[model samples]
Target: MAQFDVSLVLPDTLYHGSTMGAIQGLRIKPINKEFWKDAKDFGAGFYTTIDLFQATTWARKPVVAMERLNKGTDPSAMVRSLPKDQIPVVAVYDCNSNLYTDNIILHDYRGESRAWAQFILSHRHSSTVDNCLCLNEFGWIHPHIACGLMADNDTGQIIEDFRSQGRDIHNRDDLEWFWTQIIRTREGRRLNGLELGDQIAFSAKL
Candidate 1:
């Protein structure tokens, strides 16, 4: 069936797709903010997944992003000590189930919805301080553990396409203008089920 981190200390199994080769040490350190300048689906964190296929898809990202002008590494990845030319790899972290739960806030977005779409936009296009729960003492969204759909890496053109039609994604009118258009693509797959891939972003925080 399905497995949840019973102890809440960690998950029974979380897969990480990367090109960093063999991960050193037993610890999982999320990439630094400087590594990625773009807005992420769940802010910036160590993104993983319970779905094997999804993780496999992630394995392809590092490679594809490297060749493409858009990402392919984002150029500034050097600050994070990430390699530029390497094969994407999916590192399966088979976490052990234990018994411990406290001071952990996890927001799981089961399937796509208006709230989910809006949440992504808040992290990408703008900031929603009130809705953001991962804020720091300074009221900045440091982000928390968020489990949701993988952000569509190819959203730029989609945004531009809508813009050509004079549709502003940031517009709240016309029933959350942004969501109406996005749901028409991969993110909209929620209507049936996960068609692209899934992910769970683990924050750098302990």
Candidate 2:
């Protein structure tokens, strides 16, 4: 199983599929337009960031789906950070900009995923996200499999059911493989070690 340590910037909620024995450290730091950039370091190394904007309207499955469907976009910040030659990242067209989304895996409770999945699936392309989740071969809720979401009981049931039907569910195993690819591929890691002074690093012994 792929081990993970997630740092939560917001309190009062837990992400799905935290590692089987993962240790999550929570820090309550209010983020606004003025504070968003400062929050980047709070999510170093295999972590997720929950912006204050996200916290306001992030709940509800259909809302996420519709947002991706109607206005999904990849932001300049993420695009500028991505190394070339990786699987193409989807960018949604907004009023005057793009938003980059890294969450492609399904939600824990609502089974939601990144916006790209629907786009790829809708376009009839085999979604890399689907393959990654299905082929992981670990328990349904492994962080590698679940990606940015938690692995709650409902999420577990959906995964098992999908597995029984021979469905592709990317789990922890797939995430490990994906990370391996990122680490090994030249283009994928091309940006590695670049002096991004704004990035934050936080870790604690479990």
Candidate 3:
């Protein structure tokens, strides 16, 4: 369990898991309209992790999501819904530590701080297609890299909890506060080996 810190030099290798098959190269894309629609810890970008197991876990997310939705969800149904010829993949990349020099812009959120929680809320509130913060000048110059904890789905029920209480998931400030209030609780789960892992997201092509 190596701790991933974007503020420090990245490891020489990183793993990206997705339903998409082998890719020719990495590309920067907007935050996807994923099945969960839960806010990404870091905004739209190329997300890779220090943990191979974590990547493998994400590679099977579509199937996992389906399995969680119902006791006996159809694997074929999930397969048919995805793009043709799609299969779960864990792509490995060779990283250049030298690339993270002073010239590069990075927003590294360390630990579970209130500011980190605030940043997540800010981007989540602006993630709608029409209001993508990444596309606007008002946004924080869109860091070349954004890094933070990758588990907003541990119980797989936080979103539902918000809904059950009529909480506004999109309210930036409110969501930030709510997350901090519960960050300690999630930390305990990690101690018990139910961690969701860490991710370093790149907005720059490098």
Candidate 4:
């Protein structure tokens, strides 16, 4: 099993001092079901990435969006311009590929299959129950590994644009393109068994 590290930059307000302390204190939790309903590719779980840049981008999103909303500006446009100080904690975790292999049900959506794309598109707007059921199924299968598409900035923008137009576009071409890139660039992996002792290291400004 290959050892890998994943990181997340959360708000500094979430912890007293260090990111490891925050994890130990049970401050890190899976994203809520409501938020998962409209989530882009993968259903909800404790999402992380091997790429620090991607992690930082994901962490800055919510904070920047809120700041723009507070300032009466369009959040989507402002997200890219948001400052890094908005997210002050970077949590890193050490993981073993062995933990993912047999211990977790790995849903690899990294292919050219239209069916896979359709599945993601269908569930992106699915009911909360349905989304939760999908995640619950993962728990029932392996309880530790949750893998799927890691939607990048371009793909996210495309999806958001379509959604804003009240159109649920499931174009296989776009889906295939994005999924291929995401799979190649930042393979999705969520450590479902993440706990305090699991993290290898962390850094926080506060």
Best by TM-score: 3
Q: 1-206 in candidate 2: lDDT tens per residue?
A: 56655432322332211211112222222111222221111211223322323322222233344445656554443434434432122111111112323432232211223222222121121313223222233233312211232211222233344445554324445333322332222334322222111111211110
User: Ten-residue segment with the worst summed lDDT in candidate 3?
Assistant: 29-38
Ranking by TM-score: 3, 1, 4, 2
| 143 Cα displacement, candidate 4 (Å) | 8.3
Q: State the lDDT of candidate 3 residue by residue for 87-146, as single tens digits.
A: 677888788867544566777766766666656655654453224465352455667777
Q: Please give the distance, in angstroms, between residue 132's alpha carbon in candidate 2 and its true position after superposition.
A: 7.8
Q: How far is candidate 1 from the true structure (C-alpha RMSD, Å)?
A: 7.8
Please report, as a residue range, the 10-residue window in candidate 1 with the lowest summed lDDT: 129-138
Could you tell which candidate, 1 or 2, scores higher by lDDT? Answer: 1
- Return the candidate ranking by lDDT, descending: 3, 1, 4, 2
Alpha-carbon lDDT of model 1: 0.57
**RMSD after CA superposition, every candidate:** 7.8, 18.1, 6.7, 11.6
TM-score of 2: 0.18
Name every residue pair that clashes in candidate 3. none
Best by lDDT: 3
Per-residue C-alpha lDDT of model 4 across residues 28-110, encoded as one tens digit per residue: 43233332324545443345555565455555556655775689766655644555434334555544444322322344443
Off by over 4 Å in 4: 1-40, 63-86, 97-103, 111-113, 127-144, 152-206
